[model samples]
Target: MTRSAGLSEAAVTSLLAGDSVALEGEHELTHRFTTELLTTHRISDTTYNHALQALGRDEVIDPVHVIAMYAAQAAMLNAFDIPAPETNLPA
Candidate 1:
């Protein structure tokens, strides 16, 4: 399914940049997509990889953090049955 009206900035950034960031797309859509592609945690996508590569130095982090974070957050929203708003998306 395409981005309904209420796609998040993160989702827009991903499609436009050809990468996923900030957990874009409709909450359920984004979460489901992530679950499918990242079920095993060996995703090779550049955008997702960026999270891991930014470890130590100025900002230390684990790549899995991004996915893990999104998963928890997305699940919470899903649990609440919060629907996305309309974005007036183009055809």
Candidate 2:
């Protein structure tokens, strides 16, 4: 997706490898947000401020919404013990 969106190969590789130090601007903020959100289920005040500074209020809200929606979906699947559908993509 990053490549398709015109991000450089190096940037995409660095991101996939979880190397936030190699990323800049919005990418760096997003990486930090996702890491903290998935691990702690909360964003630090510092991270929130940085995101606000870098992305403004509207943009900052987007990731939070996405995370919440994904978490809800995962919870529902887990609650029902839903089997994941087969995919052609490699594991």
Computed on alpha carbons, the lDDT of every model, listed in order, comes to 0.53, 0.82
TM-score of each: 0.34, 0.72
RMSD, one per candidate, in order:
9.4, 2.7
Model 2 residue runs over 4 Å out of place are 4-6, 10-22, 88-91
Kindly list the per-residue Cα lDDT of model 1 for residues 1-91, writing each as its tens digit.
Answer: 3346467666766656655554533343334435545676554455344433533323323324666787788889899998877775543
Give, for candidate 2, the lowest lDDT window spanning 10 residues. 82-91
lDDT of 1 at 10: 62
Clashes of each: 5, 0
